[model samples]
Target: MSASLSVGARDLPRTAARRVADGLALAAAPTFALMAILVGAGGSDVGQMLCAGEQGLQIGGMTVMYMLMSVFHLTPWLRLIQSGKREAA
Candidate 1:
């Protein structure tokens, strides 16, 4: 028996954490866009409009970042599972 070879249950909590993080990031863009649009439509001052725009951009960036992370995390797990099934066949 090889000492380094072992199989155990997957870390479900970690997977859930990653999924939640990804979801939050995905949601950030729309949330920010809505906020900016609402604020702009409310007839606020120039400063407020600028602030909202900047915030919207930041939120969109965060959303992209998180979505990328989600893809990265999910891809590997899916590949691993597929490979295992292929090997078993």
Candidate 2:
């Protein structure tokens, strides 16, 4: 009916936003995984150049930065998973 149609119309934007977030989350997992691998494999030269100006952090600041960024980007995935769990329950 018109009310259901109206409800669907209102949900359009929210659905689109969820799609976007899901897409980003999909990309983020692989991206952070690759970055973690590269960093763990001693690929922080680029990161060091960008962050430490050739001096570099004695404690691997670049790796820490990437770790923080990866965690930050994990929000969407976490929310998606929680929502899925709730729906399942």
Model 2 C-alpha lDDT per residue in residues 11-73, reported as the tens digit of each score: 999999998977977788668756765675565567766677664333366666777778878
- Per-model TM-score versus the true fold: 0.40, 0.53
lDDT of 1 by residue, 15-51 (tens): 7889897676655555555555454445345696686
lDDT of 2: 0.74
* lDDT, residue 35, candidate 1: 53
Off by over 4 Å in 1: 1-10, 43-89
Q: Tell how far residue 57 is off in model 2, in angstroms.
A: 15
**Can you list the residue pairs that collide in candidate 1?**
none
Model 2 off-target regions past 4 Å? 1-21, 44-59
Top-TM-score candidate index: 2
Q: How far is 53's C-alpha from truth in model 2 (Å)?
A: 25
